[model samples]
Target: MLRPAASSSSGRRRRSARSRHAPPQRSAVVPSGAPRPPQRLPAAADADGADARPAALSVRPPGPCSPRWAGSGRGYANEPRRARPSQRLPPQGGRGPRGWQRACARACARAPCLGQHQPFAACRGRKRKKERERVFSLPAGGRARWLVLPGSEMAGLTAMEKKLAEYKCNTNEAIQLKLVRFPEDLEDDNTTFNPEYSHQVFGDDEVAFGYKGLKILLYYIAGNLSTLFRIEYTSKVNEKFDCVEADDVESKIREIIPPGFCTNTDDFVSLLEKEVNFKPFGMLLHTYSVHNEEAGEDITYQIYKADMTCPGFREYHERLQTFLMWFIETASFIDVDDERWNYFLVFEKYNKDGATLFATVGYMTVYNYYVYPDKTRPRVSQMLILPPFQGEGHGAQLLETVHRYYMSSPTVLDITAEDPSENYIKLRDFVLVKLCQDMLCFSPGNLMQGFSQEMVMEAQQKLKINKQHTRRVYEILRLRATDMGDAEQSRSYRLDVKRRLIGPYKKKQRELAKMRRCLRPEELTNQLNQIDLNMQHEQLEESFQQLVSDYRRVLERLAQA
Candidate 1:
């Protein structure tokens, strides 16, 4: 018995030694129809196991061991093994790839015996390092918790940005205007034009928000001036999308156009058919002709002075004045019920279809304010030449005709303009200089003698020109007569105008002297600091140069006239 036990022990030891040094066996292919033996997944606890994977990945859901992982020692007996990367299922709940990554991070954080296992510890370390890198890479004012948006939320933001980009439009380019003479004019693309400015109608930004491919079309008949307004767009932002409201284009146009305008194209065309019967309103004040270089013929034009009393004139005046809002920068309609308000309209007389037709060229409004005694000051309130007729010398003819009409009135004191535009001021200067050039006081010989009381008296008595205008005319005529190449003559002309320009500075100085007597010492110091005499001198020199430049332009135009 001792010999048999010794031999068995010795054989057991020899067998153990042989197993330690033996090479691993290869897996054999099984027959197609034969049943294979069950395969077991390697335990996650074994560091040196051939098939070991991370604990977080191994414990992921949809496996039998996943649900029991919180209470288990190793794994469930019937647990399904993890699928290969090529056969892995997509993440649930439509979370996408981001969700899968987040789920793995959470698994690593909640893993059992995380510190005791090498795979879990490595996963946790990698996750922490990635988190630290992400947090540190953010902008200075950003918080890690809210700075990074989820994949779904990020996609939503991208869609919103695209929507905003798709809807924005410039109001100036989007709005088109046309003057339709016949039915064919509407179909002609040549008739369509855009307003130069839209900030007056829209906001300062001039952006028509919340619309895609927007167009606001306004049409007016060439003769009767009947209107057709419409809006078009591919898409508009609505309450369903939580976007800003589109600009109220119709309301803005309504504020300028009168209520009697036709909104339909058919109705407007019908109105246009009746334009042949539309004649000049009130009494015919003056008639003139302009040579149209394009037409190679003289175009006849007539001016009419009308009040609210003429038949159909009130409605016509309303239609005429609507152009003021478009062309004039600071225009407002006057109360025509007052007898003092006078409307002067210019119309082009032409023969169309064997009948005489009158097209509106332009119009002006005058408010006769009562001066003391028996005189009336006729102030030019608003003047507008229709855009189609502008740059055609219609404005010059209209202003001169109006001046001649006003010149005939003995009760009129002088002509003035209410907040005249720079263009209007230039127009007035040209007209006044033209009229004054024919007078003895503004003769070339008399102009060299400098501005005089005789010039003022004659201008006020005959032309009803104010003292201010008389001074301007005298300067223009003087500039015309001046031999600018001669330094002595040019120096004399400049000194005369500069003397007038220096009056304001002298007046300011007198006021400052009075302030020194009245104001406190500290107040006087502040006031003194505000007035830089050197700057004033520089500004005065600039003003003189500008005035001289303007005078030279007037001379050039006068030479042409």
Candidate 2:
């Protein structure tokens, strides 16, 4: 117990002292006809020397401590007398006298005796000791629980999970498709060459969420009863779908497609050799081969533009987009009937033992938006190069061919892409920079003067480049021309870019000043509505640093080109 031991002599003396200071109690019973002693009251002197009874006797009730008072008296006559408990001892621990320190230490080290009357005091010391030293130390000779540090287990778990059968797909064959709706849409190769456009479209966006695009394609295919599709090429499949069967075409087509796609060439080629030509759609655009000098063999390939007018194009397109749901993260099917949509496809062509063999590679889609009176703006919407064929320069060659096809059109404006990805941006930058280098307007002397109205006008007229893109190109080219070792040249370039970033902040400051004049005095000093000058400076510096870093990368690429 925290209190002193009852067996000790000092404890007895302390208990005796406590008992002497306690209030006396009355007995619950009294003798019936007990004679009461008459109490004499003290007299007090009042005003004018008049004698009066003591205030205590006049106003107070009978005291419980008085020996003459009986239990029948008015004061607490019905109340019962009870024994009082002993004073509680102060809790030990923390900074204290040396004797208390030694006692508390001993109490903490000893285990509790649960059978004791005061369980709280006996167990509380152990709890307090644990709280003071809560380190996770293991006991000696015990079976050690493996304490894995945070983050190491996940990598091992992922590797083990990959070995399970459920982690892999059922088959390795897939059909490659390129869906487009319009002719002019195939102008920009970036739509297909840029890696950013290789996205899966989930049906969450404005136009595609409810399968509207696929519905239109299905409707078109259903109306054309006599049309047949020719599956000119395939990869990783043994079956050949040459002339497709019209009746129950959707189910048959579904059966032909493997559970997964774009990975295994051997399986893909084997699957394509199977004959399932009951219902087919699409036709071959072109077939050719490239001579690989290193291998001294001619590698044949085919390019196809999907004919929307064909009978089964709609069902084929709908099936093709199913691949998007599996492969691309943000791929959504396009509306087949939209006159503005256009499709371009690429396939691998080879001679297997003197027999012509074709396999699917990749494809792209574009949308042609009408410009104001007499022109058209072709935008590349989506592009993909099959995983197996990626890094083989097929994307660049396909994009260039598309660009050349539209370059001859008098009504066609410069090509553009929608929400180009970072990889696409890099590809676009490389292509545009290479094209602009040959033009007189982007010469070294012209770039060193910074961006100008003349340069913008020239790029717009000759290269069909927009003003915003022109400004960016100028910055990139200017950085290329600049000699960073020269202090004056580097400082000039830094200040030039920083000035452009500060333009919006300055304009906003003007608007704020006008607003402050119209607002009431009470609203003017509100911290939330006001802009801090220090914060503005910090933002400008951060923006400039980022811009300079990006420009340096562009400049490095330009030098290599």
Candidate 3:
């Protein structure tokens, strides 16, 4: 039978000394019935002159797995209705989306041995000792789409809307026509002509081909920060949508038009019919709000709250907001009221640098269909800005195009957007409120509360003032020095140390690991409450007072040391 090794005389003395002097190892898991290690937590102020009992740890493990639809006790549910997530729009990646992170961490904290609530999924397949890191993105399917439409589709949608309204109102055998949207390359003429003079060159050659086409976009952001943008546009009238650049240029550009821009967009639709010698139809506009990392390793489109990703990820989201603000400025500088053809279709590709996925949006103005002439115009409508990530106007080229094309052009009646989803109704019945006053400074949605709890209520009006759903793009860029170049070019200032980094910082890794086991913010609060309760009970126990006093004295001595 095995037995403890016989200890030499000096060894036994050393063991006894170590046991008497060393601090006890505190752990989440321990042998049952072992006297809970003497509670060593610092004493609270109210316990002065009281005997201390064993200090119990204020932290505890997290609970069980949460349900996909509801188990997340995160504050997303607590946000005000307008801030709440929409069924059509999933929770895209963001920074201020509080409850999501908190719930994920707290929930995972309850797991028996789930690692820290930090970027748990980063570098998943990477070797710990290896120097190579990973770059993550959402899985392909999880990547949402953001569509960009051209002019032909917008004109077509206007025509279709007018025709559909007439058909819906009366019963008549009417010849119904469709919209025309086209691929950009087909219209390119193979020659990358100058953006300004190209119009002069193609003036007589189907100048308004894609004018009536619309852009449909969808974006998916998987748990592992990968991005996919899927886009489809109207190509042939009453036919299929081809998102590619084809050879059948003129005919293809006449399909896939979207709804409409102005109330009287119909009034202008007929003008194009006779002038352009082509019938116009309605179009579609769709956009997805999903985000994935660009440079991080381990492209997981996961929802594991415990998993941590890059810290710079949050900063990236911030850049999106900045880019949106800049877009608003650029558009406002050119397309405001009376100048009615400047309907904006902002495609924000703030997640990945360059995308292989498709995006859905802008069927009304991707190509040249119909143009309302007003030189000094109404500004941009910056339709959708708040995002899974901050908004990005793709890059400076988009702005430069606006200046060279729209701003410099005459007879541009910058039109206002007409949306029916007018549907920005956030969840109405919100019980959670995890916002700050400062947050309202940017996203005014936070200022509203006391919404009707009924779930059936859809937005009744379209003219509602959007909670300044805009990010200060120009200001942020100025602060970050991005005004000098495109985001990629501007952000090229990576730390020299990044390349010099031999491996993952050991201290950072250890801290991340420890945070996995650290108690949550709410739990810490609960522990303080428990300690208060225990102290109250100890006041009645005379002997406990003495123990507390002794520890307080010991703590004082340690502090002095």
For each candidate, what is the lDDT?
A: 0.65, 0.45, 0.24
Give lDDT tens digits, candidate 1, residues 1-561. 000112366656766777553421211111222232332222222221111112322333222111111111223212322222321222211132232233322222222222222111112222222212110111111101111222333344444435545676888789877877678988898878777666777756676666888988788777667788888899986644332235467888888788877777888888889887787788998888888998999999988898888898988787777666556666667888889988888888887688888888888888999999999999998888888788777788888988899899999999999998888888899899989888998898998988899999999989989999999999988887889899999899989998999999999999999999999999999999999999999999899899888877877877876
Compared with the true structure, what per-residue lDDT tens digits does model 3 show for residues 265-372? 343333222322211111112223333355433321111110013233232222222223212322212221222333323332222224222222221122223534
Please list the residue runs of candidate 2 whose C-alpha ends up more than 4 Å from where it truly belongs after superposition: 1-271, 274-307, 310-316, 326-328, 521-524, 527-530, 551-561
RMSD of 1: 22.5
**lDDT of model number 3:** 0.24
Question: Lowest-lDDT window of 10 residues in candidate 2?
Answer: 215-224
Angstrom error at residue 498, model 2: 3.0
> Model 2 compared with the native: what TM-score?
0.48
Q: What is the lDDT of residue 524 in candidate 2?
A: 65
Best by TM-score: 1
> Model 2: number of clashes?
47
- Ordered from best to worst TM-score, the candidate numbers read 1, 2, 3
Candidate with the larger TM-score of 1 and 3: 1
- What's the true lDDT of residue 298 in model 1? 95
| Per-residue accuracy of model 2 over 379-413 as CA lDDT, tens digit each | 88887776546766576556655665566677877
Off by more than 4 A, model 1: 1-162, 519-523
